[model samples]
Target: MASVTSAESGRLGTLPLGYYSCSEPGDAGGQAWIDLPDKHFTIGNGSTYHTDAGSGTYLLTGKRVIFTRGPMKGVRFERSGKVTLRWIDEDGKPGRVRCVRQASSV
Candidate 1:
């Protein structure tokens, strides 16, 4: 399950794996945009891209999340115990993120 906090944006979980990328007109979960050519970028947790397209998936342990910024955030609760995320990519493309677990915090 996903731990949720108030609108405070405090550190909530652990991001074991970080991902980033360099992409063209479209950006995905692990991609970025660069003026230069043939360059790669690393996607680390807590890293924000200038483009709304830039999003990070930090591994969450047993803590909850509090969204302190943004106009809209779509967080969901399901029977499978999962969460799907949508963030702007570095290239400005809408990216989809999914998180799954057996159980959430009590």
Candidate 2:
């Protein structure tokens, strides 16, 4: 496995998948607070993706995000931000991200 480095500086609060999300639904409590306290913004649904990397399927959800991944490399992610999937040139590492409540994809 490769070392997972920070894609950017100041990008904080990393967590494992089940820390907040429930892929099977119903089990999802309001722990959505995982994506709280974000700055203003919108998302690009055109770029949202949901790939299976074995560890878990990450959901982008169309907004600013903070993600926690597995201890392995060559992983994949999913987009669940729900906005227009228009992914900007991610200055941050293309890891996990959560969107704020402004109807935007971070």
Candidate 3:
């Protein structure tokens, strides 16, 4: 197995580091939020991503992203556009959840 460094991982995929607004069926007002900061990943409702403690690590490969650890572990998403990601259901089809980049961060 080959090992990937932090610098290498950042260059492996196109997901940008920032806040994202996610919408899905059944969600309140059909909205949620996620934050991608370097190697850390956080998901929360409204704008609570900054305070949420359920954050975990993520892995990006090609056009797919997988929540590798934490509360969101096992969740997978596929890039649908320049700044959009769609959830991948267990059946491997795009689910109702769609996330778009809301803001960029350093």
User: Whole-model Cα lDDT per candidate?
Assistant: 0.31, 0.29, 0.62
lDDT of 1 by residue, 39-99 (tens): 2222233622112334333233233321222321232211112332233344534434323
Order the numbered candidates by lDDT, best leading: 3, 1, 2
Model 3 error, position 56 (Å): 1.2
* Residue-wise C-alpha lDDT for candidate 3, range 3-103, written one tens digit per residue: 96453354454466676666664545643543334323333332123314466666677677777776667778887778788889999788877777777
Q: Whose lDDT is greatest here?
A: 3
lDDT of 1 at 65: 27
Q: How does model 1 score by TM-score? A: 0.22
Work out candidate 2's RMSD over C-alphas: 14.8
lDDT of 3 at 19: 69
Better of 1 and 3 by lDDT: 3
How many residue pairs clash per model?
A: 15, 31, 0
